[model samples]
Target: MDDFDALSAMAERCFPGLETWNRDQIESQLKVFPEGQICIEIDGKLAASSSSLIMEYDAGLEWHNWKAISDSGYIRNHKPKGDTLYGIEMMVDPEFRGMKLSRRMYDARKDLCRRKNLSQIIIGGRIPGYHKHADKMSAREYIDSVLEKHNYDPVLTAQLSNGFIVRGLTPNYLPADGESCGYATYSAWTNLEYVAGAKRRFHHVIEPIRICVVQYQLRTIRKFEEFHQQCEFFMDTASDYKCDFVLFPELFTTQLLSLPSVDASRPGQAARQLAAFTPQYLDIFTEMAVKYNINVIGGSQFVVENDTLYNVAYLFRRDGSIGKQYKIHITPSERKWWGVSPGKKVEVFDTDCGPIAIQICYDIEFPELTRIATQKGAQIVFVPFNTDTRHGYLRVRYCAQARCIENHLYVAISGCTGNLPFVENSDIHYAQSGIFTPADAEFARDAIADECNPNVETLIIHDLDFEQLRRHRDQGSVQNWNDRKTDMYRVVYQEDEKTFEV
Candidate 1:
């Protein structure tokens, strides 16, 4: 029944004369708005059909005919992000009419409206059986009778029972239908389950969010108890500020090399040995996230998995759920000196604040990786970097700024500030943690949400209003997210199943 011939035939049979759409017209409708055209089949044959398109509610405000709203049932004025779902047409096979097939179709349309988060559904109900009552009463009187249940109409009665309220009567809505001298009724069904606030905010959610970026000083850990206390200190400080998310620097676990059993002079050997403490590191973050009631990006760690050593970040949720994202791009020194294996995927972490991604150190240098993450619904990209010099630190900082501008999303950078003199690779660290926004009038004059002093051990926290960002995306002077040349070029990713693994 999805074929053009079958669909056109069904329409011709259900609605004769000018009311029926031709094969070419049905094909055109499907091509333009495929989601609007829906068909229900029984016994492998089309039993009923319903079509709809998202449109502004104002267009459905008056007593306009179906052709005025939809392009003669083709739905030319469809808007993908509109707040209302406009019903174009609904037809049930004559043989299946009494089986309540039309009701099922209406239910399906309502389900679609809910799934799309539309505020309401509007339709121009045809008075097919009104021609007989035209002389006794007008279109408005006929509709009122249907609403009061004193009289029932084939189409209008069912609409009333399905929770629709008549707004007004339209004249000459369908010229071919001699019913009541060609008149229709404008009806609307408000979604009872519609979410109250944010869903209606320009189709973008408006939430209050706060993030904390840590410029942590590296220290020698004689025991796991000392490491636990340090983590609690950081978490409590950010939690006291009511931060929704707290981010830490990359390879912060290198402090574990201070254990007497691990060699502090050899970085690679120390990192490999710290693998044994990975479980404890994760447990502490998990506990902290739940205790502080916030999302925590516990920085990146070097772990040996399946005989391959790679850098990975751990995200702990307030609900005690843990997720992981591996560092896809590896630095030359990581390959040469550490013999570290690069990760294969970029993963997006979901939090109460929003969807976020973590790109460890050198991974932030690659624009495509962060772009892919943002395309997957990441509103923020957290970079956990461990740089040994001012030049290396600047590389991460500048690239982070560019990533925020290019992706048009918030970027938080946290780095290790102090050095672990006893540890080899952990020595001579430099950093200035900061949260950055897209450089626009809606943001700060400097594009910096919050920042810590360079080479200092401190936490930088700032509140981000989601509504402001949502508005900026629409009215920004340079809308980077919406100004992409998608028709000419697209961002395509190659295969790497390991990169997205939790």
Candidate 2:
């Protein structure tokens, strides 16, 4: 990567002791060892590539290593299995930039998912170490904006746009000065099949709950002004679809309102500027909620008070009152910078559609969080995330689907559209948003168009079928969410006796 020389020069502009390791270094550390790497070539050209790793760390980022894409959201409730994981590093080579390579990459990932059909896919994306310069938002937000438009979610203009779900961001996960590590958001899609040997009796008057998963084909919002415009558009679109509640990605407002031009020399001024911008967007979230008469999950942001930035996910009610969830799990930089405060109670509120619970990005990664949400009588869970690398985002997406199927609940996740910055080897974008419902055989095959896709906006709303959920829980035939062996779960989760053969 001679271009790395260019990156080296720019890096010199920032911190010391940071050097752009030569190709030899990358080869020695990655290519030779190939712990986590995948390449996709279409017609004699590199289309997409991915890589990742696993490590024991409290926070996730390593500044130079791959960010750990762990399934969050479990507040002492999600009992995760073993530490086995697959980290992915990807790039939709310049030749295949906007050609829906994400789906291809995902398909490749799924093939691997099947081969390694252990549990779930975990992508610890831009945890700093893997891609150091992931957060370089130039004063020209348009530069980053350009990135989003090219690969960014661009509103609702992509079919696979439903491929990604936004889980809220990690506290202080997004810092200024071209450096930050965030949690991966999740959106899982599996084939839905009608029960072959099924039984239904008293279903006469009431119809099955109809669900429509829609991903609007829209453009990316590069500026703060565009945020509200897109918001109104989606609100109206959802209304037209007669959907119950609408979803907005985590920190959706913050990304547009963000002022990335703080003087690196003066950290205080930068923090203050970001904080003011955050509040303005918060107000917008309230106004949008009231105007739309819908439930909008305000994305997480830096709520600065007394020099502290808290990672918070705000839920704006139809009445316009805001309910907040502060991210308790803080990455290292978060601890060093703002000292993100712990979140409040995560109780699902009663919405017109059904009972819902909201958790920010990292929160969803923890299976425990979703389990608790399901336990709390929540039929649906809304996760807002600021996903970074492709690997990190998909990890949670697959996990989300598993949770939904496991507990017979609905999970709606909205994540970043690649408007933010990230490390190298990450051509990550949420051009694909997602929705997973009652499994059907047809879905495994015909659900998503088996064709090369471009920018598309469609919804994944389908029938929730409370009757089906009841059946899934009761009928051993499907047993989708009914038969979890808690005893087996403890075998992996419980502490093992340390035996020493002295």
Candidate 3:
């Protein structure tokens, strides 16, 4: 409480032309839940602060406004045994806006929540940008637009990007404020680490995850054993580097069509014959993953499921478990000649490091797929593409980079480099496999972590820092994931009932 005057002055600077918290309110907050009240000092001056209290939170059971929940800023309604940490106020001085002080305060609150064994952190985030759009759209529409990233709110966007999900909207949340038009977004960030009846524990550290992207060379092969031997070589190299995940190029298995027994003239028949290798393909990668103790993205292959041919990518985990995602978008040539059908679902697979998604070839061109995956808690995306021309390869490359920027997640893309003379449609290939990161100071300067030389048969290995990504989403120069306008538009994946709104 000794710094009450400085804090009061800071609040006045943060919320000008509005009511600032008085000395009594500040004292009540510190007296009630001192651990929840946080302040940051820069050069001997208070730069930012956040105040919160513990309470039992049930959205369906309570309809609360800012004044009522916060006891008119006194926080006298604070409950000691509550399961939720309710954020009443967060203020950052205008002079220190871009320093990410707000993010630090949020981290502090999360630490407090874990130490106290709290279930979640709830906040009534103000949509100050709503007032500007009020004449054009309803409050709900404006909020949805922001959720979908169609619009940006100074306060709400940052909160959402920092791992908060919208619960609902609160009307007349703050009548005194004209900026939000007396409205607020009810958001919650659940603590996945929270354990019931457990004591305080130290935060877990997230180490950097290494990825090895193979610019695979396609060549005519004599038999299945030859292809198996080639795969084992790359797996051995990736494991030697202690990489967590190894990615292969899409349709690299199509080299099997180059065999003498296969009829290369009949495109459809050749693809169906390649599908015959699906069982063997799965076996080799599964064996490789377990043998090398590394996760493997076995690239993409044509598989016949229930009489339909679809492009599928497999994730072979080191634990001997396998996950698969079918290619969702089929290209014109694929539909016309290959007779391939599009996939129905977008899925995220769990790894020891974190959750990840796979998009094959043409599927990477669709931004909605990556957005849907990111919303499902995926931290990285692996793209395995095979393009016959440089233009086709650029389409996949540009789209993959865009996904990384728009979703603020790492994207590692690998593609076929050599040619298959005996195969019809797979005769020529072109690619420059690359690992892309978000365009931010915390990441690589060009957003390219590592890339194999164009049209080269080699691999690029790089370590991606998931902790840096977490911090970037919370405090980057731009929070793309958070500033979406969900009230305006959304991308819905019907399979898992997953939705990404902007």
Candidate 4:
């Protein structure tokens, strides 16, 4: 944050009387990606600064101006999952120009590019010398002259000297820059250190990930501390097995309703009271995830947002970051008894192992949701359910298996066992948690990875091989994902109030 003023002042000095990044844009850049924003200080004085973002580069796409590419200098369009590093702005103080600061900054960018395993560093460098030769020659001719040492451009010459190669030219790149006649050179520096066939940004080579599915026993608990202890025990157990993820049953925290203060007879009131435990629920699960060094799908809990109650499942990452998925499909009982509102978006969460999605009990029944999730690169779908009867439990299990077959992905499900007698609609419980895979030559017979005994309070530990899963998706007896005829039929999901066909 302290770099904001220095950066703004430097921009003003570098391009005086021209539009430069403002305070808000600088703040947004720092907040969105601090690692991409670099500054060089000489003896506590700001000498130079540079801004960059990662994006999926497409050479065949039409070029956009600086404003469009950099999101008007806010860099809000930066994609952390992208493979290319894009330089948006680079400035060296006029007094520091001869000190080779620009070269140092470019070297820093090269180091970052190699460290991030990016494919290349690209930028649209201003042709600040174009206006002087506009009438005498065309833009391309001027570029040719500059290449032959007959002419020189301040920015383009510096970029070329720093190992960048000119790819093309961008017109009207900065309409306010009259010195360049609103032209900029499309340039790039390829990362020679980048390895071929390496997994791009935030992804690693496919490996077997161990998962622990907890069939939580819905017995009465006297206090939140007891619930925390139970949760920590499973976290400890999962960590002992070196599992990457631990899945819990949905609404397992409803055991808090067994307290004297919560009245299950008034379901709506009981749900609101249960929602009050959200803070503690998040704290304990997040702490457990970090302390045990394991990712935790802390199950679904009733949470109130904007005066509406929604059942939201949280992914407590081992790094202390939290991701969430709201249960998009609400059952009749949930709506009638608890007044739970349906969530609007289905999302895939990124993990060190790969990408996964959480589908609450009823959500798995809707094929569109899981289809969308898998289409968005989810390899595993975890369903945390709380079904009160055998029929309901079978519905979840069957649908989950079907999703695995049709999507060509893994589905792991767990549910609450025992009984929460004090909770009205949640009194009786039935579940047989299992991890399922597609029926193929490479998978287990009957397509079942592992299953726990029905209605038992136990956890199933199993390993999922992603490399085999990928091969199965590509070379299996049948390719369900690839065989989808999107031209004829498609599943669409609504995001940010916009419908997008998957």
After TM-score superposition, the amount by which residue 362's alpha carbon in candidate 1 deviates from its true location, in angstroms, is 0.7
In candidate 4, list every pair of residues with a backbone clash: none
The C-alpha RMSD in Å for every predicted model, in order, reads 17.1, 26.5, 22.1, 17.5
TM-score of each: 0.59, 0.47, 0.60, 0.61
lDDT of 3 by residue, 229-347 (tens): 99989998887676899999988999999888888888888899999989999988887887676899999989998999999999999777999999999989888778999889888
Candidate 1's C-alpha lDDT? 0.81
Model 1 worst lDDT window (10 residues): 493-502
Instruction: Give a tens-digit lDDT track for model 2, residues 1-502.
Output: 3333433343344223433334554444353324344555554444455544332323333322222231221112112222223433434454455444554455555444333332334442222221333455422232234235532332112212424332222333333313323322222233122122223211232224433333333233456666566666766565444455666665444343233443323333444455666776777767766544456666566677666677677777755567776775555544554345655445667665566787776677777666666766787777665555567667756776777666666676665554333221112345345555435442334222111122244444444445545555665345644466665562122113442110
Could you tell me which residue pairs clash in candidate 1? Answer: 131-180, 344-499, 345-499
Off by over 4 Å in 3: 1-206, 496-502
- lDDT of each residue in 126-158, candidate 1, tens digit only: 887787788898778877777788787899988
- Of candidate 3, the 10-residue stretch with the lowest lDDT total is 493-502
What is the descending lDDT order?
4, 3, 1, 2
Candidate 3 achieves a global lDDT of 0.87
User: For candidate 2, what is the TM-score?
Assistant: 0.47
Question: How would the candidate models be sorted by TM-score, starting from the highest?
Answer: 4, 3, 1, 2
Name the candidate that leads on TM-score: 4
Question: Could you tell which candidate, 2 or 4, scores higher by TM-score?
Answer: 4
